[model samples]
Target: MKLLLIPDKFKGSLTSVEVSKAFIAGVKKSGIPFSSHYIKASDGGDGFMNAVAHYKACISVQVISENPLGRPIQSYYLYNQESNSAYIELANASGMELLKPEERNPMLTSTFGTGLQIKDAIEKGVKNIYIGLGGSATNDGGIGIAQALGYSFLDKSGNRLLATGASLSKINSIDDTDVFEGLKQIRFFAVNDVNNPLLGKDGAAHIYAGQKGATKEMIKELDLGLRNLDVVIFDKYSFLYAELPGSGAAGGVAYGLKSFLGASYCNGIDFILELSGVNDLLTKEKFDFLITGEGRIDEQTLHGKLIQGVLALGVRKNIPVIAICGKLDIEKKELKKRGIYDVFEIQDSTKSLDYNMQHAADLLTAKTTEYFGLLLK
Candidate 1:
């Protein structure tokens, strides 16, 4: 029998590669006669760079950049010389993980650091840029990124304003006189997994600002600012992206890039799968079973997440798909309805959360062994 294991990072525990290794060990321990192939996957979030770096021979470039809070830090991106392309994850420079609980404030954060990385890559003569727009800490609607690229946001008095969530409403005009000339030569692809619009209830501020430390009043203010910016963008660029799918990704960075940089958006998982050549493998290889998973299995997993993408592939191939997760929150019947043949959770109910997380690799291996052993019997 042949099995394919593709899993996302277990978040605060094992990486996708580590998860695959643990499962492979479990299969061996079960004494099952099987050949296994595995791939590390990410849905354009924190592990995006690692996933791409695993399959591509690339050079790492490090640059000095500011964090969301304007603090200087070192960030890096992967560059493929052969393709003249660069892969950049916004999380590396301006993600929520970089801020402390008390320091989390969307109104004060910016995506300037992410823009700096892109600027460096552009200066390096890359013709293609793939930007992962997840795990961001800002709600600035990409104004900071624009500022970094030589676009000035000016007030009614013609004074330049600092690009931030709180300052979006004060902008009277956008000037691109000093914008980089090479931008016209490069193609920008924004990799995202969500389809939220740029404004309204399902939009950037209303749906995501609270998590970035915004209160009810602050969310309203941010939404207003986004609406104001939307008006300006439409008047100047004649493109109404506020209602477009994926415009809300990265707190409206997707929309901003689309309007300012002529960027195209694509699903993160699909992009990764294509870039890794996994789609070709799925078409040519036959497997007895396919296993995929993430940290948690819930209704959200049915969206454009990594597990769902894998399940879709399994469905097309008419192969049973199994999920092994840290926690299972959905009913088995519900998962079955979505074409998942089985689901397994590795946590011990008697254990504390810390204990389970700390020993996730061992628990995962044991659980996989036990489950496959039963299957073989």
Candidate 2:
């Protein structure tokens, strides 16, 4: 049997590479003769930089930057010397994973840290920057990033307002007197999978703020803040990013970058697959089955996630695709309709969430062994 394993980060547990290793261990333990190949995959989320760096043999450059709360932390970006391009994943600097559950608050968090990473890359003389926008811990409408790039938000009183979700509504004007000089010379690409606009019922605050620890009231406040910021931006820049596709990505960082830095948007999965040359590999390689997975399986998985992208490739090549996740929330019929032959959950029903998370690697190994053992019969 020949198997191709491509998995995304498990989030709070195993990374894609680790997940592949566990799967390989299980397949070996099964003692079934097989040739296995694996590729680490990401949808331009948390582990995107690592995947890209590995695929391109890029150099890793680390710099000190602030976290979402303005605390100092170290972050890194992948530098491809050949292309003079840098790949930076926002989650590295402004991710929710850096905060404890109790510490998560979108109203207070900021993307300034991510902006600093971009600044650092520019300072290194990179001509192009690709920012992976996902796993953010902020809902500031990207004002924090603008602030870091030398744009100032001022209130009606002409006093500078701190760049954060709470201050979005107080903005009376934008000041770009000291904006980064090299910005116009650099090409910026915002890579993300989300398609939500910047504001509204299906937008940033309503759809993602809850996961970032926003209360019901906070969600309403954040939504209002985004609206207010949009008004200010339009008045000053003569452009409205409120309804732009993917404007809501990374808590509106996509919108901010597009509005201020002239960033273009790209589908995260497609871009990553192409950059990693996985698209070419799919054409050259043949396998009995393709296995891809992420942290969870749900309706959202159908919407441009790593699994969906992988399954699309499988469907095109007429390959059987299987998914393994920490949990499963979608109907089997729905998965079948999408070209997934089977879906496996790593956690046992009786296990506690903490227990499941702690034993994720081992559980995955056991599950893979059991599943393939059956196939061998």
Cα error, residue 297 of model 2, in Å, equals: 1.4
- Candidate 2: deviation at residue 351, Å? 1.7
Encode model 2's per-residue lDDT on 177-292: one tens digit a residue: 99988889999999976777999987889988999999999999999999988988888879977797789988888898899898999888778778777667777977888889
Scored by lDDT, the top model is 1
Per-candidate total of colliding backbone pairs: 0, 0
Instruction: Check candidate 1 and list the clashing pairs.
Output: none
lDDT of 2 at 59: 86
Score candidate 2 by lDDT. 0.87
lDDT of 1: 0.88
Global lDDT of each candidate: 0.88, 0.87
Worst ten-residue run, lDDT, model 1? 298-307
Clashing residue pairs in candidate 2 (N, C-alpha, C atoms within 3 angstroms) = none
